[model samples]
Target: MDESTGLTIHKSEAVALTQNGGLAKAIKPLTKEIHLFDTYVAGVSYLKDKTVLQEIKIKDRLTLQREDNKFDDKAIVVLSSDGKKLGYVPEKDNIIFSRLMDAGKLLVAYIIEIKKRSIDYQQISIGIYLVDF
Candidate 1:
């Protein structure tokens, strides 16, 4: 945990918080963020224009929305800042996050890494954080 900002650091990645300009500078005052989990955005291959994946950058904030009626009841859709549907939170990972959302907790995500394996495949990884205000 950071004594100055009171933010919890998980894994060595939280170290990026300091090197990458800190989340405090990017979010509103009085808001606190707790790092939850990190996972790659699933279903990227389904996107119409794969090039859209290139526009995302590390530290860019993303949004998570609960899809109650989705085939997977625990589905949570990950979206870009502009409201573009990037993909789901991965069926295996959405259960707990969905439960939290169902209980009224706010969750947000940020781009942590973008990996390009080939001309047609790019993987976007994000860190999910629970917000308290």
Candidate 2:
């Protein structure tokens, strides 16, 4: 059942059970492997499931720069067609880059903020922030 906050406490408890310690630690590798497996499966499915839709071409490719000036092999490109700007997609972040090559018109390229939080043994939470595309 949904709680007052529209969340199921039992589900949260289940996730807590699989947290960083205890059973979670033991099965962490397995969880990662499963995640990779699922990604591979979904990628294959998308490739096999071709759409009978029209092709949309993007005008230009945008360069993604990191705030720290770190060079990476990937960048996010916003693509569009019909001379109208469309939404941006994080490139290389998606499994099917080639498929989305001609989906929309090219727009702006800028770095976005990324945040990560972690809890240590003492249960103190630390947050790390980065500007990445």
- Which candidate comes out best when scored by TM-score? 1
Worst 10 residues of 2 by lDDT: 33-42
Candidate 1, residues 4-123, lDDT tens digits: the string is: 999997767556665666766645676989999999898888887565576778898999999865479899999888878888899999999999999999999999988887777778
Best prediction by lDDT:
1
**What overall lDDT, based on C-alpha atoms, would model 2 receive against the true structure?**
0.27
lDDT (10s digit) by residue, model 2, range 31-91: 3111111111011112222231123222222231222214423333232222222222333
lDDT of 1 at 98: 97
TM-score of each: 0.74, 0.16
Q: Which stretches of candidate 1 lie over 4 Å from their true place?
A: 1-28, 49-51
Residue 56, model 2: lDDT of 28
CA shift at 113, candidate 1, in angstroms? 0.6
